[model samples]
Each structure stands twice: as structure tokens, then as C-alpha cells.
Target: MNMQIENNFSYHAPKPGQPEIYTAIREKAKELAYLIDEKAPNSREKSLAMTKLEEAVMWANAAVARN
Candidate 1:
């Protein structure tokens, strides 16, 4: 008898209530994006604002993971 080998893919099965967390994350990201300075008077300031927005998103995601 011959046996065939198969490859398996990993699935990201979210924990219970993760959908709510996902939704909240999305909303917060939107809020952060909008709150960021679109025109910060200069390229440097705009980059800084964008960085802050990115950090906000990361923080929100981390907070949700902790909850």
C-alpha cells in the first residue's frame, strides 16, 4: 500500500467574543486615523502625527489582547 502526504494550513481561530474586540479595534483605528493631523504644517510634523496614530492602533490592539 502507498501513502500520500498532505500539507496542512494553520487557522486563526479567534477566542470567544473576539468579534467584538475586532469591531472595537476597527473603530478605534478609524478614530485615530481621523484624529491624526492630515496637514501638520510640515512633512516632519505629518510624519510624527502618523507615527502617533500607528502607536495608538498598536496600543489599542494590545489592550484588547489583555482583556
Candidate 2:
């Protein structure tokens, strides 16, 4: 099977003492997850994307808890 992946992700380091950055990360993660779902609903790629999304949410949650 041939798969086509399309991504346009941009990363910016979270500014010190700015908790809002975590929110932004969470939002971007949601968008990426949606794209993955739409592109490959029930496949290995979707599972991988979901795992990455889970990781991003974990990081965001950690940052939120720390602040």
C-alpha cells in the first residue's frame, strides 16, 4: 500500500513563564490529530499519529500542572 502524508506543522519554543503556550500546543495537536483521522481513519498511520497526539497532550498537561 502507498500512503501520502501531508503535514504543515510549525514549532515554536514555549516562552518562559507563559502558560498559554501549552494551550497553543494542545490546539495544534488537535488539528494534527484531526488531519490524521481524515487522511487515514483506521490504520497504522492514524494509530501513530494518535500516539504522538497523546504525547503532546501529556506534555501540555504537565506544563499546565507545573504552572
Candidate 3:
């Protein structure tokens, strides 16, 4: 008899799909802060990050309005 060791890979996510809009917004804001730091002020990437931050804000406001 012969046996071999096996490597492990996983795709099992434990999270549910329920939306936490407020938390989502806060987390996105944190991400934007990181991007701003990485890209710095007045750079092209800064402009892109600013746009994404604006979009996140708009989405958050819409979610709030709906709620």
C-alpha cells in the first residue's frame, strides 16, 4: 500500500449575503484612505481614488435613503 500527502485549497466562504450598508460604507472609506496614502495628492491615481470615494459615498447615501 502507498499513500501520498495532499495540499489543501479552499473556496468555502462563511459569510452570508446580507447587506450591512453602514458598515460597508465605513470599510470603503477606510480603503479610500489607504489608496489616498498610496497614491498621494494630485497624482492620476489620486484622481481615480477620489472618483471611487465619491461613488462609494453616493451609493451609501442611496442605501440610507432607501432605508
Candidate 4:
């Protein structure tokens, strides 16, 4: 099997300092969510924006963990 594929598929435990990185990502996402709530009108577009934001956060965390 390819090493990169194996690593990407495997679970990665939080190493030192990773928790803080995750927290920062979450905090920033929360801030963006709040801004969206305050500024963007509630609609399907707004909902999709929120959903994409969530996906972005997940990918960011995965990047941190996988790298």
C-alpha cells in the first residue's frame, strides 16, 4: 500500500500543540459564523455558506492532523 494513502486513512492522535491548533480553527470558525448570522440574511445560500464553513473547518483540522 502507498504510505501516503495509509497515513491518510489511519487515525491520528493529537500530538503536542495540536489541540491548540484545533481550538484556534474552531474559534475562528465561530467568529465567521457569528458574522454570517449578523450580516447575511437567512436563506438557502446562507445555509450553504454555513455548511461549507463547517466542511472547511473539518478539512483544516484534517490537514493539521495528517501532516
Candidate 5:
């Protein structure tokens, strides 16, 4: 039997100016993309979720750029 376990990974942004923070964000985005792909009920919902995630990453990048 193939049992699929649901993941609840939380992304915590690391210290500013550290590479770890970027890595963390990238990993988090990938996880979110996977969850969105797997659990979204329909294409519209999936598109919305992906758009939101993209916006969030852009916002994070902007914040980092400002610092």
C-alpha cells in the first residue's frame, strides 16, 4: 500500500543578508508549489494559489532588495 503523508512544513525566513534565508525561501516555494499541485481542487484554484505564491516571493525579493 502506498500511503501518502501530508506535509506541514513551515518556512521561517532566516537572518537578513544571509544566504540561508534565500535558500529557505526557495525551499519553501518548492514545497508550496508541490502542495498546490497535489491538493488544489481545480485548475482555477491552483492558478490562484500559484499566483499568490509568486507574488509573495516577489514581495520578499523586493524587501531584500531594499535592505
Candidate 6:
């Protein structure tokens, strides 16, 4: 595998303060999830919105982990 690609695929252990950053990201995502659950009507669109929010959170975490 290419070195850059290998590096990208590797698990990155959290450095000092990184776990705190990850926790903050997750907390904010949770707050948005609560608002979505309370305010959005029960429908397919709302379901999709929730799914996308989950994807956003995963991608955000990956960005922090990889960079």
C-alpha cells in the first residue's frame, strides 16, 4: 500500500487533549440529536436528517483522528 494511504487507514491513538476534543464533538452532536427528536415531526425526512447527522459526527471524528 502507498505510505500515505497506509497512514490514513491506521488507527491513531489520542494525544494530549484529543480525547477532550472528541468528547466535545460528541456532546454537541448529542445536543443536536435531542433537538431533532423533540422538534422534528415523525416522518421519513426527519429520519433521513437524523441519519445524516450521525454520518456527520462520524466524519468529524475521523477528521480529528486522521489529522
Give the candidates in order of lDDT, highest first: 4, 6, 5, 2, 1, 3
* TM-score, prediction 5: 0.62
RMSD in order of candidates: 8.6, 12.9, 12.3, 0.7, 13.1, 1.3
Tens-place lDDT digits, model 1, residues 1-67: 2222111223345678876887887787777666665435557877787787678776675555544
* lDDT (Cα, tens digit) per residue for candidate 2, span 1-67: 2222111133334467556766777788888888888888697877987997898788676645543
Off by over 4 Å in 6: none
- Please give each candidate's TM-score: 0.50, 0.52, 0.41, 0.94, 0.62, 0.87
The residue-by-residue lDDT of candidate 5 on 1-67, one tens digit each, is 3222222233435455656666677789989899888888877878988999988976775455434
Which pairs of residues collide in model 6? none
Note the Cα lDDT for every prediction shown.
Answer: 0.63, 0.68, 0.61, 0.98, 0.69, 0.90
- For every model in order, what is the number of clashing pairs? 0, 0, 0, 0, 0, 0
lDDT of 4 by residue, 30-64 (tens): 99999999999999999999999999999999999
Query: In model 2, which runs have C-alpha deviations exceeding 4 angstroms?
Result: 1-17, 60-67
Best by lDDT: 4
Cα misplacement distance, residue 41 of candidate 2 (Å): 3.5
Q: Supply the global lDDT for candidate 4.
A: 0.98
The TM-score that candidate 1 achieves is 0.50
Superior candidate under lDDT, 2 versus 6: 6
**Which number leads on TM-score?**
4
The number of clashing residue pairs in model 6 is 0
After superposing all C-alphas onto the true structure, candidate 2 shows an RMSD in angstroms of 12.9
- Which candidate model has the greater TM-score, 1 or 6? 6
